[model samples]
Each structure stands twice: as C-alpha cells, then as structure tokens.
Target: MPLHKIIHINETTTAYFWYITEDVTSLFRAVSLKDTSLFRLEGMKSEEHQRGFLAVRMLLQHLGYTDYDLSYDEAGKPHLSDGKHISISHSHEFSCICISNKLMGIDLEKLKEKTLKIAPRFMEVKHLENLTTSEQIEKATVIWGVKESIFKIKNEKGISFPEHIFEDEFDLKDGKCTAKLHFNNQIENFQIHFYNVEAYIFVCAFPNK
Candidate 1:
C-alpha cells in the first residue's frame, strides 16, 4: 500500500508521517529493501531507520526523481548521482527532505525535555545570556536547530556548537529567527532561517553572499 498521508510543506519541502501500522517486513519491502544488513541497525532502531528511508524514497519518487542513488563524500555527507542538492532528516516520527536548484539543508528534531540538559554543550555564554527569561529552554532548542542545519549545509562533521556559530535572540511571535555563523574568522558572516513545526523546530541556511 502506498503512503496515503502526505503533507506538502512547500514547493521545495515535503514531509510524510508514518504511523508504523504496518509490519517491519512490509515497510522494508515498500522501500524496496535489499541487503538490509548494510544498515547494521537492530530492533526498534532498525525499524525506525527503515521507515524513515522509505518515506524519503517515496517523496523523491513523487517529485519525479528516478534513478535515486546516494553516495557519501570523504566527509561522510550524502551526495546525489544527478548532482542535485539534497538534504535528508528524520526524527522519531517523521522523515524530511529538502531539495532545491540551489544548495540547501533540512533538519527535523523531536521536541523533548532533554534539550535543557544538553543546552550547555551546544550553546555559548552569549546565547544563554540572551534568553534572560523562563523560555530559555525553547530558545536553546531553536539555536540547536540552527547549528544542526548549518552543520548539514557545510557537510562537515565534528563541528563544535556555540563555539562555532551563534543565533540572534528573537521572539517566536514570527515563528522564526535569523542566525549568524562564526567559523574561526574565515567564514564569519552568514544568516540562517528558523521555523517551528508543531513541537519540533527547523533551521535552514545558505551563503549570505
């Protein structure tokens, strides 16, 4: 059975929600799974990952993209066979893909309480000080999303949060924020866009020039 529920966020972005109603085996088959052993995930993690990939593949097919092939560069960032810019993200419940004629990145994270605990590791002193209210936790999560998006756009791993980037303190009244990139004085000026998706937040960045 095809994925009946489709939510089109925009012309360039689409999201699909899977309820996990089907068995794991069926889900894999729907995704045209072959040699599942390559993923090396087991149990619940395996199921979740497969489902996410299936949704992504279906979305790509819907977009008229055939001959879908993915390869990773030396930095481990996924590349496409057709040379199109693509970004893939998956949270606990949904998988998201952002494709555009220009370079882009997409991310979806489940809103959770643990964000507070991990805030320090990802946020800088200025970012924390900018919160200055009971809504610090929510603010931190948005910043984290910005960092994650930038990380994906750069396609480089091992990027330190807070120390490597910064986001302006802004109200959520507009449901979005602009962030600045600080990468060792080499690439110090760039902006990112942030938006909220229900309980989750999403950030996307591109070259400011």
Candidate 2:
C-alpha cells in the first residue's frame, strides 16, 4: 500500500498515513528531495529508516508539497514553508504526517506487549484493570501514544511522561480522550484522538482551545 489512509481531524487539521511496501530505491525514485534531505537519507543507518523518511516525502507530494517545503527547527519540529503546523512520525512499516492551522502533535505506534509491560512507568496502571490481555495492550499503547503526541506538541526538555503528563480515565471504545501536561509550572489541557490501524495505534493531539 502507498498512501494507506487519511483522517480528517477537523476543518483545519488532517492526518495522512503511508503504508510502506515499496523498497527504498523505488520510494527514492518517486519523490524529489532537496540536498539536505538527500544528505540525511544517505546518513541513515538502515534501509527501513530511509524508506520511512521517503514515504513521508511521498505523503507531502500527495498533498501538493515537496521536500523543499519541509524544514526542521533546532528542537527537531517540522515546519512547512506555508507556515502551517506539521507533525511527523513513523514506526516499523508506517509513516504519518499531520498538518494543521493550529499547534498540534501526532504519533504512530505498533501494538506490542512491551508497551503493556512498561505501562506503570508512563501511565496509571489502574486504567488497565478489568481488561483482557489484548485490551490491555491496546489501551496501554493508546496511553503511550497520548503522552508521545503531547510531548511532540510541547517539544520541551524535562517533560517526563510519568511525572508530567496525565491521561484522564477513558474507555478504549470512546476513541477520544483528554489529557493534561504539568510542565514548566503550568498545566495545559489537550484533546486526544486515537485509532487502530491494522496492528498499530495512531494518535493525534491538539491544545484545548
């Protein structure tokens, strides 16, 4: 699959997903990269990482953007030439980019038993009670993504998931939740949206307006 899915988050925000089935050579040939991107691609240690990076460019092209229009700041946040907010993520075989007029963040994580095992380090273990093994894995992955999505939005140093971010009680079936970030001596609320993509979990976060 190429452009696997697109989620219209709202009037001003949209998220795009690319399922990477193409080899690096094919993906590289399909997208035009600026010199810096090419240099970064050449420096990547693994073909999987290269494919994920190119897949992001392919997604940008799908929306009338190219590598030239994408840039990164010192904090490693992505920026568009047009000034729209953009967040990018990739894991295993999936790559994603979310663009919005407002500040936002996104994350993609494959469902794994390890996430559930380490849940207590990043989230409230009580939320996993009364769930089956599979449900535990799914819910844990969502909470991890919630913290990751919010972290990407903040992109500040010293924000620990366990110590600073908290997810309110929410059911897995609800497909949405709210979270708070207690960082830099201020508490900021966020709206979270999550989905199951094959065996992966996709999450998006936007500051509460």
Most lDDT-accurate candidate: 2
Summing lDDT over every window of 10 consecutive residues in candidate 2, give the lowest-scoring window: 1-10
For all the candidates, what are their Cα RMSDs to the real structure? Answer: 3.8, 0.9
Candidate 1's residue-wise lDDT over 1-209, tens digit each?
A: 44434444446544443333455566555543324323533444667776666666655565666323655677766666777777777776666666655666666777676886778787764655655454566677777777787778775555676677776667755555666666655654445555666666666665565
lDDT of 2 by residue, 51-81 (tens): 9999999999999999999999999989999
Which regions in candidate 1 have their CA more than 4 angstroms from the true location?
A: 1-22, 33-45, 125-134
Q: For model 1, give the 10-residue run with minimal summed lDDT.
A: 32-41
Candidate 2 Cα misplacement greater than 4 A, ranges: none
lDDT of each: 0.62, 0.95
Compared with the true structure, model 1 gives a TM-score of 0.76
> Distance from true position, residue 191, model 2, in Å?
0.6
